[model samples]
Target chain A: MAGELALVADILSIISLIIGIFFLSLGMIGLLRLPDVYNRLHATTKVGTLGAFGVLLSIILQEGATPMGIKALTVALFILLTSPISGHMIARAAYRMGVKCCEGTCMDEYAGKRRK
Target chain B: MKRRLITYMALPVVWCLVSGYVTIGSLFLGLIFGMIVVEPFSKLYRLDEVVHPTGDWLAKIPKKIKYFYVLIKEIIKANIVVAKIVLSPTINIKPGIIAVPIRAKTNIGITGIANTITLTPGTLTVDISDDQSILYVHSIDATNPQGIRDSIRDDLEKYVLEAFE
Candidate 1:
């Protein structure tokens, strides 16, 4: 029974790791193919963070409920808090620098509301 | 006074978590050092004005934990949507920055909402008005701008109101 459980854990770990790697690669593809800085930021931040979290989950599955697993969970928590902030900051900076959105961008709500 | 005492006591607890040692000697040393660390910041900690008083803040922890759980669910949903958008062969997206009028009263409440919006689905809090009445958000998809604002007001802001206001 113990051996069977260990085998289950290993299978789950591999599946999760593959899922993570898949998302990370998709993020990279978006990064290269996207039109402008803002879209790139979206792709990298949102998809990339999820990908990283997937990898962390795989670590937990592999390690079970031990201290290292707990630490993996903590690291995931910190990533959730910080990744969006980084994305927000970068997008804001790009806007402030007067970077233009791509042609496909359907709306620009802050179009006329700039003081600077 | 009470605020000062609470921070002084709390710092050592935070220190223990960070240092990852629970020995009695380490805790006692943390207490002494925590006092020294927090003393200079005593005047700066307007805990009564800027935040809930210490006891009230402590009382809100369970509600905060519940909020964290809700936030995680939103994040996972968001990531899946983003993954689909990014991975699709066609370069599909509609991006805009809209002004999201906010209702949170205090600085802590406003910041809490802002951080929550930035972290969760399709939205990012870019700037706030001088009077703090509105938050300017750049969302990856705001084709239905009102939907974005309503979701933030209802889902995110309500719990923030519960915790901070």
Candidate 2:
């Protein structure tokens, strides 16, 4: 029974690893291809964060509820906590710098609003 | 009063995680260390008023759990949508910033909503207005501004309000 459980875990870990790498690569493609910083942030903050999280999740699954697994889980939690904040900071900086949106862009309700 | 106790309890929990030691001896040591340092830390930081829960926090646990589940589901959906956008043949995405008027009163609720918007689908929260009445969201697909506003209001902000406010 233990062997079977380990096999199931291995299978799930492999699947998770594949999905992680796929999302990571897609995020890279997005970073390269997207027009502006705001659009690119949509790629990195969401896809990239989830990709890293999935990879860490696979590590925990493979390692079980050991010390290493606990550490991996902590790292994942930190990533989730910090990734969006960093992305928000970058987007705010870009907007403040007057980085205009791509040609396909249409609206900006924050155009003339106070920056406070 | 209650806030200080919770912070004292949290110190040991954080210590256990960081040290990667969940043994009884480790936890006992952690508790001792927490008890010793918590008072000085609180005094230095003036955290008495800061750690207090905004409302009926204990009663919101079930709602908070539900919100967490929803957030996870939205994250997966976001990834799938982003993957499709990136993989498509023609890169035709209308990206722009739109002001999303918020109804969340608490600071924590507003921050939670902004963070949730950034983590979900194609939206990234650029900034909040001075009065905290508006959030500037950069959405990859801004063809229909009302659509984005409605979706966030109905799906995301309501959950944040329930959980945090």
Identify the candidate with maximal lDDT.
Answer: 2
| Per-residue lDDT over B1-165 for candidate 1, one digit per residue giving the tens place of the 0 to 100 score | 556666767877655544545567767888899877766766677534343355687888888988888877876777777677776778677887788999997888887888788767777777777788888887888689999999999998988888777
Q: For all the models shown, what interface RMSD does each have?
A: 2.5, 0.8
- What CAPRI class is candidate 2? high
Per-residue alpha-carbon lDDT of candidate 2 for residues A44-98, written as tens digits (9 for 90 to 100): 9999888998798899999988888888888888888899999999999888888
Task: Return the TM-score for chain B, candidate 1.
Answer: 0.85
Stretches of candidate 2 off by over 4 Å are: B29-44, B48-55
- Candidate 1: global Cα-lDDT? 0.78
Candidate 1 wrongly placed segments (more than 4 Å): A1-8, A64-67, A111-116, B1-6, B13-55
Residue pairs with backbone overlap in model 2 = none
Residue lDDT tens for model 2, B1-165: 556777767878777777777888878888899878777777675657645454688899999999999999999999999999989988899888899999998878888998999999989999999988889999999999999999999999999999998
Question: How far off is residue B14 in model 1, in Å?
Answer: 4.1
- CA lDDT, every model vs. true structure: 0.78, 0.88
